[model samples]
Target chain A: MMETIGIWVAAFLTLSMFSFLYKDNPFYKFAEHLFVGASMGYFIPYTFFNVFIPYAYNPLFLRHNYWLIIPFVIGLGYWFRFSNNLGWLSRYPIAFSMGIVGMGVPMSIHAQILVQMRTMMLPLTNINLILIFIGTVSILLYFFFSKAHEGLYGKFTSVGIWFMMVGFGASFGYTVMARLSLLIGRLQFLLGDWLGLIK
Target chain B: MNFSDYIQKIDRRYIFIILAIAVILPLLFPLGLPTFTTPPVLSLYKHIDEAAGTDDRAVFMDFAQSPSTLPELYPMDLAILRHCFLRDIKVLTISYYPQGAAIMQMAISEVKEDFPDVKQDVDYCNFGFRNFALRVPITLGMGDNIAEAVETNAAGRRLENLPIMEKLKNYDNIQVCMEISGAAPGIIYINYARARYGVDVAIGVTAVSAADNYPYLQTGQLVGLLGGLKGAAEYEELVETFANNDIPYSEKKAQNLSWRNQQYELSKVPYKFKQARIGMDAQAVAHVLIIIFIIIGNIGYFIEKRQDKNKYVK
Candidate 1:
């Protein structure tokens, strides 16, 4: 059946990708390159259907609205890469998008990031929290002064380094967890969905 | 650097082999470990409840993610869509990513297994994928010529003729626009649709992008958010709880009047999410593996450093 063939193809593609984990072989390379090509080719029309024709051309040409052309013109500036004289025009939209995105960052920081970090930085009320606070503050101060960190100060800074190392260790652990989750997901598809071996 | 020094370096192949086993073993035989849903996930579920309400809430889901991220991303879309349909809310899906539309269609269809009577383009509509970015969303949400973008359903029938959208006044008919993406366009929706048009937005994004959305969620800009697989799992749990609580009866005489009877009168909800539950277990084990790797890598570094010191002292 067509469904069975689809499952097999999916399994093959997934295994082909995981094979890269063992060693950089031609199979991995072929699959990787194929994926890149397929994805890119897909994105063009995908963007065209989901973004352009609906948002731009529909409003501009179909509705005969003129102002909507602002983004349209800005988007067209990307083509300036081909024109030597007009290469500078590309920077206009780039600068505009930068300005807009830049404006968003400050708003986002005030609303989201700073508050979250502050929330994390709050004083721990428990004994464990107190030790963590003391260690974090002393280490942070040690770095702020930027001294060689010898004597009591050095000892204090060393505690900060230890806290930092632990935090970094947790982050690295989470990153691995995230990547491995994806790998497991692929394997699941190959075994359960594609091959029907585990289902 | 002697030839033996090169040999002393374990081949990357060894690392690959270990990673392969780490992934495969869990799938073949799961540990059934529990994953705790974090605060952000809880917040996201609450927001979805508030925005979608008890009425006919609509979601414009963008299921656009690479296979690399499908395991983490798809579950969130599935959970959210199932929650909406179970609550009898309408869902409208359009994909900005090409592969995304097909995937979204498939996810929606699976949800349909529960709601057999729900007709496509009546109770739901697949506008397919569009490419115009901000321009398209602004136009569509503004209630302009949306038909021009996806003129017809995926089957090539015109949308104007479709019963659901025929009377759709504007994007106001939509209660939420949820974008599950791995890239910039989802954020673009946040800025253009939610900010500009006051659309309630929820984003289900990867962990890396999830942090970035904190600002949006904090700003009250994004109504709800599901981050990676953990968030998806949490959402699924919330729906399961909602479904259980809504069930009509525990008493024998009342059993006939149970919510299950009403549910049977309406849609057929699948028992539960099979894939996401399994993924959560794999994730917990994978977290342990990563922690172990980090420790080993650090030990290797320290060992090499001590050897270098010995050489210098000699």
Candidate 2:
């Protein structure tokens, strides 16, 4: 019975959202605002219970990890951003986060950059490899503003344009599929789960 | 007005209504346009299948998807978990999105219904929602030591005590890390898990961001990729059509369970479980409708251009 009620609520929201296809009206606006407000209302308490109590309060009080107070105070400092006079205090936590990310950047670069470069530096013996090599070079060259597009360079640029167009076309096709899937999902819920039309 | 003029002047609301009808008809009467699995999706399926052979191994999955990308990501998420449970492989799911962990619980319960003998603590576990702030530390630390990184499951239970965590201590025990998201968090797994720990990484992303990740597939940084609803449909096809359910499970007493011997059938899979393929049917019909509209618009443009030229000549 609870599941049935949940389905009805979801079906109502789905229809309310679809009401915009004809014209933007009160139903769409109500659904949109309710979703935003409800999510915020849900997360505030969830974070306090999940993060604050478990990670912070328990460790400091029960486990006696007093060292946590330093970071705890630093985290609290972020609230000072709302204060008119002491707003400068938030910079400590912000800088600490920035510095940590700065240190971690180079460590991740080897994986994102070096490994990919190694793999792309292939032998080019196979047709697939050759196409990949050409495609990579031509695409990069197309973006190279130093050289004007003429003669040999122009031909490569043209090939790059074709490759980009194909990529864009594929991306567009996938977007279409993704959008249609959302519609199908709602329809499935309404037809099968709500009304029992499709089994 | 001429047909060309009518075609050119048709209101966009009409197109929207047409698309709605086209997408809806397929759900009412599904035309099962044959689904095909790409190499990337197949490779991920094979990885899950191979993980099943080694009873001690587990697959790490991050459910980082949100409500907006729900339709595309949720079906694939269900399919992968179904694959894992069907083959008797252990799975550990964590989420950074506030609501993503709830989706994780929903999916686990749904799939568990399909396989009753699949126990909770021994066969699978959920780390639940870690603070998104801890994503980096968890990603890197799990590579070194999963138990140490995640000391407790979502319920505040000790992770080391879970029967499933016995041999699964680190990335070495993990067969692969599958990041099902909007392509944002998959990069973290690729850079940290696969790159740092030498674990294979696969991603399931929405179709729009799918192209951005193809270069990773080319470079082999990503072991496999599932792009949007079609990708999920292909995965459902592979599992429903090709997964050999005849497994020789003998590592523990759980393997002796009766449901482990039950053969999987396409007919038995619930409609919710096969939502991806059903979505694909709608996708096919909608695509055909859009293609027809594109041709009509082009034809109208050409006729309008020729008529303008004739007017100039006169």
Q: Judging by lDDT against the true structure, name the best candidate.
A: 2
- What is the lDDT, from 0 to 100, of the residue B79 in candidate 2? 88
TM-scores, chain A, per candidate:
0.80, 0.91
TM-score against truth, every candidate: 0.70, 0.92
Q: lDDT by residue for model 2 over A12-112, one digit each (tens)? A: 99899989988999999999999999776756665675567767887899899999999999988889998999998998887876665753576568777
Candidate 1 lDDT tens digits, A1-199: 9988888887777778767666689989989999889877877766665556656777799878999888789878888967989988788767765555554665455434554456446666678657756765876676787567789878887888887777666555445545665776777777677656554
Interface RMS deviation of candidate 2: 1.7
- What number of clashing residue pairs does each candidate have, in the order they appear? 18, 0
Model 2 CA lDDT for position B114: 78
- Worst-scoring 10-residue span by lDDT in model 1 chain B: B248-257
